[model samples]
Target chain A: MTNPGIRDDDVLKAAEQWRREGRGVAIATVVQTWGSAPRPVGSHLVIDDKQNFLGSVSGGCIEGEVIVNAGEVIESGKPRLLEFGVADETAWRAGLSCGGNIRIYVQRVD
Target chain B: MRLDLLADLNAERAARRGAVVVTDLADGSQRMLRENEAASDALLKSLNVRLRGSKSGVHEHGGKKFFVELHRPPLRIVVTGAVHVSQAMAPMAKLLGYDIVIIDPRDAFATPARFPDVQLIVGWPDNALPSLALDPWTAFAAITHDPKIDNPALKLALDAGCFYVGALGSKKTHARRVEALKQMGVSEAKIASIHAPIGLDIGALSPPEIALAILAEITLYLRKGEEASA
Candidate 1:
């Protein structure tokens, strides 16, 4: 569970709560996807500055990479767009393994 | 998104209203549009199509890329019965991501043992229906059979503009129900809106099969009713 009273799947609510707690937080959303995507577009992954995170932008495909990028987004207070595809050399390591392409938008919660 | 706008979007969601957050990927500029306010938007045509499908994605227009994040309220199933069919429907509704509420005045039938992990309302329809706050995203099914229980709830649901209103009854039983609703002063249009002999014509016999049929009918209305009407 994300918190005591919120639903486990409510990523926005969880992100808002983390922001209220005075944490440097970033919300990464799956803005676009193509070909056998793991998670649908609009799925969210909330990451705090301390690396604590919840929700998912993929089916565990590129979330670790998103968290890494989110650290910069949180520090800069600017949004960044990230793209990963199976064709990329990082496909097996940091990219989608299921032959899919996805774009994630990581924005700091203000 | 600005802090006030984020709070506004969350408030809209908490009130069960659909909100569309449009973000400019180029500069991180953003604006939140509520469902009700979408009609006046310049992008209403595209937004209407997307919202009808309940989707969220990037929309490209005039060389600008905008991520339209559509957030809609969770669907609800409010059943005015704790009968065998309601028992069968609880799990299916939950599986379909609907918040199911089973209402029955009879304590024995509305017991927790019969319906687990479902919102069970043990009270009369007049007393319980108001608190549920039936809305357009809700599908109301009155399977109680007793007019005393179903009639009032049906009136409330229809008046509240529930997306789907179904009552379990035969043609003859529904004829009687129609007369009773008329006597209660419900509008002719509203009374005519009840889906009699509820559920799709799936020729269902068992309770679970009937539950499947009802849910199928509700899904049809919920998803395709807009296109059908348009």
Candidate 2:
């Protein structure tokens, strides 16, 4: 099996490659976590202009929202710090019902 | 951040040199620092401690927060014998995210049928080890139970500063091996580094069990130290 860190490296490389190909790319990274977050801090999800993504920040709990926000970041060229937790009303809708909290930082890379 | 920095980071990783990518969170600027460089002494010292532990995390220094991403070379295991224990150990090591290389001069024992999906060197230790270039990320296992095969490899592993060196032998056998290493000009300190009667004392009897014990001991040494569980 491949190491998780190596897989993260692949995400970085893919993000750089997408940017070099003139596709808008944004990298969403898990900067902090509390309680039972599935993936640890430093985990990354790379998204491109075509809504394609590589790697993951959460275990299918928050990727859709992050991807939608990443689209806006790519269009505006502004970074964002997003927070999600069980206390939020959208947590149940987004499936983050595991009673954990996470902070993700998203930024465009070119 | 410049794309060339990413290229250089990839180059460092490909060369098996440890590096750290320090990202200034406030500005999103990133700089790659090789382990040996001295440009950022204070930050490098902090980064070196994290790198040695093989961990990556955020750190605060000088009122600024930076994400220190460590890029360490993959851990490696070099088995000097293609014995039954090795057959079991190689795949287990792979499962634990280790790169394995099996070295044995015996054509019959070192056949691909015995060890598949692993790098095999059909040469003696003295010939194969130089190219393997054992380093701190490497663990060396000598299990042929032959003086001609195991001794030279242990010596080379000691010289190369392999993190773990293990040999399969009983207590008496290890005592004699120690004397032989002394005759070959190895110091007491270096000879003490060898984990003879290799593996943790888990009362392992079968080959696979012994492989598990050995891997456990190697992991303990890598994470902790000889003082903790040798």
Give per-residue CA lDDT, model 2, range A26-85, as digits (tens). 989887788998787768899998899999988888999999999999998877888899
lDDT of 1 by residue, B1-230 (tens): 56677778888878877778889889999889888776467774654535546678888877888888877777899999999999999988877778899999999899999998789999999999898888887999999999999999999999999989999999999999999999999999998878889999999999999999999999889878867435
Q: In candidate 1, how many Å is residue A65 off?
A: 1.2
Worst 10 contiguous positions by lDDT, candidate 2 chain B: B46-55
Best by DockQ: 1
The superposed Cα distance between candidate 1 and the true structure at residue B182, in angstroms, equals 2.3
- Give model 2's docking category: acceptable
Q: Please provide, for model 2 over B79-198, each residue's C-alpha lDDT reduced to its tens digit, 9 standing for 90 to 100.
A: 989999999999899888788999999999999999999899999999999988899879999999988999999999999999899999999999999999999999999999899889
For the predicted complex of model 1, DockQ is: 0.45
The positional error of residue A105 in candidate 2, measured at the CA in angstroms, is 3.3
The runs of at least 3 residues in candidate 1 whose Cα sits more than 4 Å from the true structure, single-residue gaps closed, are A1-9, B46-54, B228-230
**Best TM-score goes to which candidate?**
1
- Which lDDT values do the candidates have, in the order given? 0.86, 0.84
